[model samples]
Target: MSKTTPKYLLLSLPTSVVPSHHADDALEAISTTVSAENGSAAPFSIPEFKIGTLDALVQQADELAKLESQCQGVVAKVADALRNILDGDEAQIERMMVVNDKPVDQYLRTFQWNKVKYRADKSLAELIDLLHKEGASIDNDIRFKYSQYNQVKNTLATLQRKQTGNLSTKSLASIVDPRTVVQDSEYIETHLIAVPNSQEKEFLKNYETVAPMVVPRSASLVASDNEFTLYAVTTFKKHSVEFVHKARENKWIPRDFKYVEGGKEEERKEVERVGGDERKVWGETLRLGRTAWSEAVMVWIHVLVLRVFVETVLRYGLPLDFVSALVRTPSSKQADKAKKNLDDKYSYLAGNAFGRDKKGRVQRDDPQDMHGAGEGSAEYTPYVFYEFEFN
Candidate 1:
């Protein structure tokens, strides 16, 4: 009979013996053929055959088992290498090794455990919480200190006012003692004379009596006009009264004095027209009066510049909080520039030179270009105008 080619063979058999077929289909055929050859076709059955035939079948089973064991060993080695690379520490490596010895499902569970543990250990959420607490504490401390300082300063001022009376007096005789009068004539003559005592003693008595009536008395080294004469008294006593008198006589009226009571009514009216309230206008006028006309004009220009900056930044949706943060560095020129720009922008908006657009959004005007040229370099470079829109 011609040899019938076997349709299927055991996995352990040499490739030459196994007919070329799909592995799953061949395995099914082999089981069917083995069942037919044996008395029972169940996988556990062994046919009563010659010793040589039985040994061949047993050897095939043993080889198949060994092949499966080798595949499992290769997988284990691969898993160990992967664990060493992924696990950052010894404890993690040991845990991974143990998990690798387990079934696939158990290994996945172990991985999740390690991931959660690692994240919990190094989380930055706690650090952020601590920072918030510290910042709040510092803010509270600063507020408390400011309040305390203000209260103490106010208390000192009240006490000083209670102690010192009005120091300005048109009658200098009230503070000074009368000169001693002499009586030397051929005939008896009467003459007015001061009580026999030093002029200093008389002035001391007058100061002690008048100090209580001084108005708005305070401890500030420099004083306002209302407080000026009050401090002058103390200064005169500490220094020579003659020196104080000489200084007061030489005092050329300050530009501020020009606006004080009856100076320039026109300037005061102009300030009032620009600023709504008269008091505020007066303060601004006084401050401007203290400086030269050119300097005063520069201040107005600076105010306009700052107003442009604030409005533009606001238009760009930059948070006010962030603006403060960005400009917080004390010595940074960039920060200073940002601050000036914000101020200028705010001033422009307040002055009503610029208004909102149709959509009610603040419209920013183009800033004027600035340039710098020196003797050495004739080239002029365009400078950026930092500006912002304000609502």
Candidate 2:
């Protein structure tokens, strides 16, 4: 009820010794300790992550996610506007007739689906510039961030295409809060418990055994999800703390929120305001500003920022898989000279220069291809291949 009292005890505050996001600091310590023990630096330096870089990137990503979702809502509005104008469905006419007390044909004004993409366009341009400015273009140690950024950017673009299929956007349904199921009570304290899905049945079966630990007849099932179950635990207000403690001891996490001031209904309304009403303010602004799409694009760019930051932390300091391979080129007067140089440079590598089939798959193994060595030789085995065309 009170913000001081965590609705969800498990998520209220971090229980980890080091914060989950402080891997950079942890790595820095490990690297220093290792180097000191060795009494010297290694042949190559490891990529060092910035202190608050990941936090900043994640924050940016959160902003972008909001933009992306809001933009989709805008796209929905635009589609509705266009539909109303073009079709003027009977539903709209009937609704208008009911409201204005006029015949359908008397209505002169119609809807127009305005584009919000233009403003989002400018935001995206600015975001790209920001990434280019702060990106790991320098320092090969961290340059991998550039590659990860590109991957994330490409994926976002692909997802965008998938999101707004056929130039139409559908609004996703708002979440239904489970708290509505609980009845109001003053002397009784109600708590929401989240249990891991793995042991959901076990917890339900043993619910009675644990309920008395906090208060008699305290536990009741409210809702469940694929990953977790939410249980409503009602007990005497004096025993609320004990209930929460016992609940945690049984691996049930208290929902994270302040339910004391106004209780679950107030918390539910706050969540609804955030998800439904408050979120539309931005959507309305985008519709007014004509830049909804632009905001969406900017948010996508922000997603790439997080991708780069996270990828760098997880992969940059680790061993990499470096590779080299011979490439085939069309024979030409220039090709002969280049092929000679390539051959000289990689003479040590085994050659499998047989021509590939039209499908780009390697041809069947032939004795003539490898000469006598082709007999039972793994080097002459047929292998699948792909030809890449660059634009």
Candidate 3:
């Protein structure tokens, strides 16, 4: 879809004007009068939902609408997460949602509600319960995978940073040569010092005089970065603390390091292990994100269809007879125009149960409206309307 184009709008109306297989009448009106030249309309197939009694459906309608809203929010959130995982490339999200080898736009234009997954034979309450479980399961899986990937990614970044940072901040394990380190000495100990390039001469000239029991002429250059040059100085194990203090007094920063045999190889192994783990977790999380996006979208559509069915029953008051459609307007301006056109054409469907605000927006006359209704009640648009966008 283009940047200006909004996604499909799910609409339902009484079949008195739009009969089965004669949806072209409604589509023609929508494309010309509703969306104008900016958008298109198509028939959205809604499965024959099992409708219980009137009281049961009224309560279920509120619950179903809320669930549909929640599922739509999840779709947007998961899309954002998947985009972030792919370095903020929006196209990658569309690639993940391809259905039957079709692109996202094509799939949505010719979409078919999945009936096998949400069997219509089940009652309204059963379907609501199923959607709740599906939504929760998808949320938990995405949360877990994203968390795992983030942890591994952060650890690998720290390790890779040390490999490139300056000596003062970098790890010393691989930079220090094992041969130059005085290891396993009874009294003599090796200490690493970071000396500024300008102070290297002074450090080398007075190294042996820093403390008592210092090994004479033991100061040797180890490594050099842009900021500081690393040197190793040898002194007595008992006088190591005094030597460090005196070195600091001369503005030489002492880096605490313990030399071990095969330390370089150990460091290399640790970096490699973490890097491998990062790659594995990244792939797993991406796969999980893609699957969750698909599942969540399907579950959301099912909830939307349920809301349409229940609202049709309560508004039309008995035998189920209505035509639901999917309308896609290219821009928000066109969408507002489409809604105005729809309200103009279908205002009579509201009968005595609904009213219009000062701005002519549809408003329910139910008791819930007087006392500040919930999300489900507040969303009751005239002629059974709900709008959603694709990521």
**Residue-level lDDT tens digits of model 1 in 1-391:** 4322212110111111134534334334433433333211111111111122334433433332333233333333333333333433545443433322552223222222122222223322332233234333433433343344445445444434433433331212222222211123343221111111223244333432332322122112222234222222322223333433433343311111111333244434543444343334333332322221222122222222222222223232232211110111112343334333333333232324234567855443432221111112333212112211100
Candidate order (TM-score): 3, 2, 1
What lDDT tens digits, residue by residue, belong to model 3 across residues 230-300?
Answer: 99988989999999999999989898677677877887787899999988988888888888887887788
lDDT against the true structure, each candidate: 0.28, 0.36, 0.76
Q: Which stretches of candidate 1 lie over 4 Å from their true place?
A: 1-122, 167-391
Using lDDT as the measure, the top candidate is 3
How well does candidate 1 score on lDDT at residue 64?
27
- Supply the global lDDT for candidate 1: 0.28
How many backbone clashes are present in model 1? 29
By lDDT rank, best first, the candidates go 3, 2, 1
The deviation in Å at residue 7 for candidate 2 is: 59
- C-alpha RMSD values across all candidates: 38.3, 27.0, 4.7
The local lDDT score (0 to 100) that residue 9 gets in candidate 2 is 4
The residue pairs that clash in candidate 3, if any, are none
lDDT of 2: 0.36
